[model samples]
Target: MPLSEHEQRMLEQMERALYAEDPKFATALEGSGLRVHTRRRVYQAVAGFLVGIALLMTGMVAKQILVGVVGFLVMLGCAVLAVTGWRKAGKPGEAQAQPSAGSGSRRQGRRKRSVMNRIEDRWQRRRDEQQ
Candidate 1:
């Protein structure tokens, strides 16, 4: 159903509020779905996977083990590429896999440590409960 006038106005107000509170986040969210490269990458990945499957079938029919192995590897790589592309597609404006000259690496390392610590703590708690 279409939103009522009051609901539309309320949504507009909320959007404005969100933008005012965190313009970067609002902009990122707005632009998340506008990545042409990501869509292309996904399409390429699908094509790569299909080509790999065809190569594998041909190799099997021709009794070429090396060709079949190469095709399997290509298929695996394409599958991983597609998954990563999908995950990163929502944040197209982000930089590539390079750390900035400043504290970017440190911040990422800290984030990783925090995540690992949380996982370790969870495991420890489970172990303690079991004991």
Candidate 2:
């Protein structure tokens, strides 16, 4: 459900007042909840990876094949989780700044032309300098 207009206005006013009262504190708290949650997940995955490593080493010293296999699987799963979480977390403002679906191809076209134009300009400059 969406907030009523009056509630939104009140919330905005409170945010503004908080910023005015302590800009630094407000900035420190500005990270989105999703970003924080994903970061926490990544951290947990890393810790789990470390635990897996310890388990693998213990299994090796004890000559236990099953324990070693389980440890390897745990490490692999944690690594995958860490990678996915990191990808999802991206830069804090990246999701907010993304272009809409309709504009993606158009933006890519402009980017390609700009890159080609730069290369052409560099080639022309090199030719002129060699003359």
Query: Candidate 2, clashing residue pairs?
Result: none
Q: Each candidate: what lDDT?
A: 0.77, 0.80
What 10-residue stretch in candidate 2 is worst by lDDT? 95-104
lDDT of 2 by residue, 1-131 (tens): 23434555898899899999999999787768879899999999999999899889889999998888888888999999999999778786664333333555887867865676677667767877999
Error of 2 at 13 (Å): 21
Candidate 1, residue 37: Cα displacement in angstroms equals: 0.5
TM-score of each: 0.46, 0.51
After superposition, the stretches of candidate 1 with alpha carbons farther than 4 Å from their true spots are 1-34, 91-131
Q: List the residue pairs that clash in candidate 1.
A: none
Off by over 4 Å in 2: 1-31, 96-131
lDDT of 2: 0.80
